[model samples]
Target: MSEKRIIVTGASSGIGEAVARQAVARGWQVLAVARRAERLEALAAEIGCETFAADLTQEDAVAALAEAAATFRPTGLVQVAGGAKGAAPLGETTIEDWRWMFESNVIATKRVIDALLPLLRRSTAAPQQDGSASYAEIMVVTSIAATVSYQGGSGYNAAKSAEKQLIDVLRLELFGEPIRVMEVAPGMVWTEEFSLVRFGGDQAKADAVYKDVQDPLSADDVARVMTDILALPGHVSVDETIIKPVAQTHPWMVHKGPLVAKG
Candidate 1:
């Protein structure tokens, strides 16, 4: 089989970084994209994967990223760059926060898709025994909040929900084509920078989010799911997957302590 090349966005930290590491371990070629050049450099040095530093929210940056990625000829795209900015009540949330969420999650995703479509098409693999060709894939990382509503999560919920809609429509639009469009929604992933960034660098506030929670999902946990999905036969598509830790039943509901048998 020929080499498989994949482009992973938001590869500087958290789940994105973990995905890059795992994908490399599986002997796949990766082009890791993010805004932090220094971090990307370190990841590249450690894992032997190519890295590109570009802010997905910037038009010029994304355009440049697409150009560079074309040279890599990616067979798949894993988008994990978007994040929540603030967690405030609907009325109390700043308009700026909502706008940023939309731009980063929704608009940025659209831009990357539009920019890279041609290259993805060019990278389609050979036909299998079933007579179905292994086309390029597009995998997006959404949030459980997209489908489940919760207090202080309206802004993020709106953004990720819109992103989910975008992916759904994209799949429809790309129907009859060989390309695969997939989405994964994760709940309660306890990453170092995620809650910290959402809470504006308040360590205590971030710490409180996972306080007493037994084994909240980690970056590696989510990354493993993502890589496993990518490893499936090209003819098989896992359209939508929802991943949550055992402690988390919903975005607003999490079991804080160890699990025990019911009396």
Candidate 2:
């Protein structure tokens, strides 16, 4: 079998980084994409995968990325480059922050998909032993914020909700085609920078988000779920998966231990 090729966006950190590393370990030819050249370079050095540094929000950069990706002809595209900017209530959320969230989560995802559709289509052209078409997968890493609304999470909720809807529509549009669209919605993942970024680098504030939370999900945990979905038989598609730690049931409902403040 030819080695499988995959492109993972947001490859500089968090779930994106984890997915890229895991993909490479499983013998896939990985193309890691992110805006940070230094981080991508470091990841490439460690994992021996190809890297592309481009801001997905920029049309010119996305175009260049598409040109590069055409040569790879990847069978899978994992979109994981997204996050929340501020935890402000609807009225207090800055328009700038809301726009950033939408651009980062929804618009960026759409752009990358549009740019890579041609390469993704190539996966279907590969010959199969059964004379049936092979499948190409597009897996999006969304958040539980899409499904449940919480106080002070309006911007994030709206952005993720849009992304989730987009994925659903894409799946319906591509139903008969060999392309498979799937989404994984994770809750309370405690990565090194997720909370910090959301809280504008306030270390104490970031740390407080996960304080006393038992075994919160990690980037690797989410990556494992993504790769497992990809490993399924070509004909089998897990349309949507929601994963969270046992302590978390929804966006705001978390069972912190007694020592943790409940407020």
TM-score of each model, paired residue for residue = 0.97, 0.95
Which regions in candidate 1 have their CA more than 4 angstroms from the true location?
A: 125-132
* Pairs in clash, predicted candidate 2: none
| Model 1 Cα lDDT, one tens digit per residue, 1-263 | 55679999999999999999999999999999999999999999999999999999999999999889978989999999999988888988999989999999999999999998888877774664466566789999999998999999999999999999999999999998888899999999989899998998999999999999999999999999999999987768999999999999989899988887898
Best by TM-score: 1
* Cα distance off (Å), candidate 1, residue 129: 12
User: What is candidate 2's TM-score against the reference?
Assistant: 0.95
Q: Which residue pairs collide, candidate 1?
A: none
What's the true lDDT of residue 207 in model 1? 98
lDDT of 2 by residue, 1-263 (tens): 44578999999999999999999998889999999999999998899999999999888999999999988878889999999998977888899989899999999999999989878887788676666668888999899999999998999999999999999999998878888899999999999888998999999999998888888999999999999888887778899999999888887888787535456
**lDDT value, candidate 1, whole model:** 0.92
